[model samples]
Target: MVNENLATQVSRILSKHRLKINDRTLKRFLTALESINDVLTPELIEILVLDNLTIGESYFFRDRKVYNFLRKILPSKSDWTVLSIGCSRGEEVYSFSMVAKEVGANFEITGLDVSPQRIEEAKVGCYKFWSVRFLDENELESFFNKVGDKFCVKSDYRTNVTFTAGNFLSTSFDKKFDIIFARRVLLYVENEGLAIKKMYDLLQDEGLLVLGLGEYFPQVLEIFEPIAECPCVYRKIQRKEIATTAYKNVSEIRKTADFTAKPRAENANVKDESKKLKAQKEVITKTLERELNLEPALRVVEHCLENKKLIEAENFLRKLVHNFPTHYLVWKYLGILEMEKGNVRIAKEYLKKAAFLNHLDDEIWQLLRLTKGNG
Candidate 1:
């Protein structure tokens, strides 16, 4: 059970920052707070909980397809260094080890996690039998030695791997790596765009950054193109190189004059326009919600409208006006969505309600005239 005062404080902090904290997350927050409160005070507890909450569960060769891809593309070098960020226990780092051994590459692997206890456990390199389920009996016997109830990594393999406890937000190393495997860590960060920019700076020229199969970031995708999609991996291309490549591709297509080529440019422009509209809609909706105590229905309607989901936006706005008759902003947005949908009669009705609430705005008067003309 959580202390009610503590839970309220946590909730207030999250809400003040406009973060969405659902019931499940609140429970996790409470549990994490209780676990670390003995060693940390209230002020430091949130930071510690945030650091320890990022440990992701993994299995041996969790995604075999990604490993297969790595086997193909990883350079066969005598001295390569690989960094795995947020490597929870040792599974992914060990997976990298297995791959390196198979490719006959002499490699050093560093696995960093935020939890000191997890780092200690990883240093021991001892795991339960079930953790190696993917390995055959002979392979397991070859790679690990039985130690009491657990299996310890074989000495030959153990020397190449090191586990360190470090926070991703503040940690830095003097050396650049040939490969940085950040996997699913970025999705949980408070500022993913800034984090990606930092990661981009850490990569060597032509170096690889492998995000996990299911990981997706709109911000990262804008900059990094998919080099190999089989494993859903991305490579950090130099900005100048990407520009040069695009220029060459465009020049070639222009010379060829293929009808299929025009659509690609048009699609790029459309995507840019869509992004701008979405940003505008978010600004407007957030401002209104924060300043006016507007209904959530109106905000959802505005989002859908900005994303060009006209029918859904209209329906949502109509529902808001119907359910919350006293909310003027709901009526205002309903009118806007209706106008965008070319339904002037419904738009006029909604604009009337908005006019009743606040008659001072010139824009409202202009929209009312336009709606009346259409009706």
Candidate 2:
């Protein structure tokens, strides 16, 4: 059973993207989250969500039969554009380049994944032995160099490829592809129907779509025609549109799942900005109380100093001394402000008159001596 509080919080985030899971899954994932981090901060929560959803093991030539299927089925278009969704760690992309070359297909590949760590690794064009384990001897000889224990992809297969980190369900790249490899991704999504429709729309006319063997979506078949002898691949045939009523019912289900995720907790940047703004407000309130004079509100000025609002205090005191030249505390604080600003000569003049107001004041005495010594 999922604890109500944890379920509520996790579901809120999931629902915004039309996703949900059983309470049991949430409980186990939450336990994993707690084991990793003691505090439930927004950063930790973001890490948990992204880590769970985007993580997948990938290696070169994974499911080689799929690549062979694509090579056999390539359209005659001179330029082929392929979108590799969830191309974790870039193994698929480098592998695709080799397959495209063997079939003499002129193509460009775009790799997208939701994991920042994976996207960065993809861009680095370097891979550990684990990621290239399936590379046959000839492929190893032609496409990679053994650097220490890892393999680096030669530039020929690495060109015309780009990697970006993004959420698949929420954001869409505004482009179409002749082929979209969405293998292994739909198994993780709650709304496979929605994802399939999205991929369908992303395809060019009669374009091809492939999925992992484990993923299945019978409902979305109205838009995609399955290919013979390809267990999980589909060719985008002319639309056999669903009835309007059924489409509306699906829309309503999505709307029911839609929820507003809570805004993240107040962060350090927010707290510091709040303090700085509050200090500024206090300075304004106190400055106004003294009729903009630095005479009676020295405590407010000191409050600004204590808060390290030297810019605000200096500006206020500069204005105050300009209007009330003979005000002792006004001149005294101006001297202190200038001293902090490293203007010892100017500070000496202000301190001399402030000391004249009350020669016996120990603070004024010390300030005067400080200005003179520093000068």
Prediction 2 TM-score vs. true:
0.58
Model 2, 1-375: lDDT tens per residue?
435565566667666545555666667887776565547876556556666744567778766557778778664667889999888888888888877877778888998887777889889878775465445456777888777657888888877888888768777677799888888777667888888888888998788887764355555454655564554566775554324212223333344334334233423333443454344334434534443233235557777877878998987776776776766677777877778878999989888887776443356677777766555
Q: Where in model 2 is the C-alpha error above 4 Å?
A: 1-9, 16-25, 240-375
The alpha-carbon deviation from the true structure for residue 195 of candidate 1, after best TM-score superposition, in angstroms, is 1.6
Who wins the TM-score comparison? 2
- Per-residue lDDT of model 1, residues 262-375, tens digit only: 677655554454454355335434543443323235547768978989888867766666666766567777788778878889889889987786553345677899876665
Clash pairs for candidate 1 = none
Q: Model 1: residues >4 Å from true position, as ranges?
A: 1-23, 31-52, 243-375
List TM-score per model, in order: 0.58, 0.58
Residue 346 Cα positional deviation in candidate 2, in Å, after optimal superposition:
90
- In the predicted model 2, the residue pairs found to clash are none
Best by lDDT: 2
Q: CA shift at 248, candidate 2, in angstroms?
A: 17
